[model samples]
Target: MSLLDLDHDQRKELAERVRQDYEELKSKDLQLNLTRGKPSSEQLDISQRLLELPGTEDFKDADGTDVRNYGNLKGIRDIREIWSELLGVRYDELIAGDASSLNMMFDLVMYAHTFGTQDSERPWNQEEKVRWICPVPGYDRHFTITEKLGYEMLSVPWLDEGPDMDAVREAVKDPQVKGMWLVPTFANPSGHTVSQDVARQLAEMETAAPDFRIVWDNAYAVHTLTEEFPEVIDIVTLAREAGNPNRFWHMTSTSKITFAGSGVAFLNTSTENIDWYASYAGARGIGPNKINQLAHARFFGDADGVRQVMRKHASLLAPKFNRVLEILEAELGEYDVARWTTPSGGYFISLDVIDGTAARVVELAKGAGIALTEAGSSFPLHKDPNDRNIRLAPTLPPVAELEEAVRGVATCVLLAAVEKLGA
Candidate 1:
């Protein structure tokens, strides 16, 4: 029977039994971790050729520009060409550089703070208070950026369709609400993909802030862990059609596609924003690491090559995700005390345990020597108001370790539920 279905005596008895089991688990001293969505050693090994790419003899790009040199602010055209096809934007429009998309995102926010975008009348930092719409049960790193930069984050409900568009439409009526972050495909923590209709609405929605921007961090556009890859509408096209040519800045990276830290990052948007970014970036540095760009270009060779590489990634990743789902089903399926997403593509499984039990479950897991993504990590300010959501990252651990880690989580979930029901 479900925890809620049991009588007070039964719940109390169950809680005691669960507590004993949890104590026994703690004695094992297991050091398994599911804290981050880092790639496994096997995953990293797949891209080993990248380390020795563009071998000694060949260092020139398609245009014969010596990649070893220090200039090509817009990135090498050949590399841009390759990403453009995958991103569905024009080849010349992409600005390729930086190993981390997060770094590029920070620079954009800093630039907006210091100098403002083309449409902004004044710098963001100068404003009394700048706010951005945050889709909850979302990426923690995205929220951290806004928080660190002093941006007031307005939490919006992330629906199956995407962030609640009606709420987003209403939230933007306030003039100080500068913009919002968009993780369009296989979003972090929750694997909700933004449908084309939602993408169009976000691009065209009326806003009080004339320079409202969509920090489109399409980090997982190509990181599908399934055979069925879903594509999103072109935001740039939709924004321009809606008379807001510069409404969004699209950022993506090959961090998971190739080497996580040693991969190429990209930013694409309107020609106007591209020029604005280039002018500011030119002042920041001469150019990006073109050698890295060349290496990636050589490693993939073309867009199709990139797709083939991702398929290989899916092969390795899908099984781990399936294992987590299977364990949750076997252990907690009949409890009626928990629910989790069966994502088609993404690095995580977003789990929602009984209300007010998520934190306790995480605590129990930690005591048992299994490290999980801290409760509330998927929300803004590291706070899940409901205290019910837990993000399960299955990518970092080996299959054998993941099985144990997930079972431990299931045990914690059951224990916490019983304890809460007992009370």
Candidate 2:
């Protein structure tokens, strides 16, 4: 019988069976982790050539500026130029930084609240409270950043096309809504690419807050598993054309493309925003590590080289993704206890279990010696009111381990669903 259709006694029996299986599995000394959205060792190896690019007297920019010494607060010119091509933005509009674009975004919010942006009439701190529109089933780190800053977060349901634009429009009408976080291309966890129509509507929407900006974190811009994926219209261009020139603060990084801990990151926006942010950012530090930028520039050479590198990543990752899908199909297809997203590209497979069962499933998986990202992490404030969403990361583990992990997760889901129904 399906877990949902099981009687109380049957469910109790099923739970006991699952518990016994988990105990046996845990005692097998198997080590498998499928929690974080991290790339595998083989994926990291693809960019190993970057380390050799800046050896034996090659540490200067084209203008004779020493790459090792710090001065350009907005990054070296050539590095910006390279990223501009990758991000589909102009070089002058981009501000390349160190490996942490997320850190930069946090600083942006903090600065806005304390001192405001160039266009603001007053600092956000003087206001009653600042608010942000958080799309549900989004990146946990994105929500955590806003919550930690004490900004009032309003959760908006994310559709396959993107976030519900109607809700977005209504939310932004409130004067306290200062910003919204978005991952437009193959978004984190959900892997839903924002539709072109939705992108345009978001750009053109009227907001009561004059300084409202879209915190567009394109963390997985080029990390695609399939060539048949939808093409993302450059939101910067769309926003500018829609007469909202400063509507977006775009960010990207090579964390997944190169070494996760040491890759370069960048932000792109309108000229006015760039000038203001540069002036503010310069007060703190001299600049990002130019040597790293030079190394990446040499390693990738140009945009085409970067695309070639992504193809290698796709080859390594596609099978792992398919394996998870295969296991899900084999174990849970007929029972219908949950549904999942089959993304064309991106780093995650988002699963939606029965309401109020996700936390139990995660606990059961842990008992079986398999780790997962904490349940409800995909939602704002780590609160999934329905307790339904779970993000499955398949890229980090080997194919065999991923298969085993998927089976374990499937078993957990069945156990949890059955118990919930019985209760």
Clashes (candidate 2): 0
Note the residue pairs that clash in candidate 1: none
Q: Which ten residues in a row have the lowest lDDT in candidate 2?
A: 226-235
What does the lDDT come to for candidate 2? 0.86
Best by TM-score: 1
**Compared with the true structure, what per-residue lDDT tens digits does model 2 show for residues 1-423?**
466676777667877886676667677666678889898999999998887887769999867899988698888877787778776787778888898888889878878888898868899889889899999889999898888879999999999899999899999989999999999888989888888889889988889988998999888888889764346467787888888888899998988999999989888888888888877788878888989988888888888788889889999989888889989988888778989999878899999999999999899888788899999999987889999999999999988889988988998888787677764
Which pairs of residues have clashing backbones in candidate 2?
A: none
What TM-score does candidate 2 get on C-alpha atoms?
0.95
Winning model by lDDT: 1
How far does residue 290 in candidate 2 sit from its true spot (Å)?
0.5
Q: After superposition, how far is residue 377 of candidate 1 from its true place, in Å?
A: 1.4
Residue 258 Cα positional deviation in candidate 1, in Å, after optimal superposition: 0.7
lDDT, residue 43, candidate 2: 95
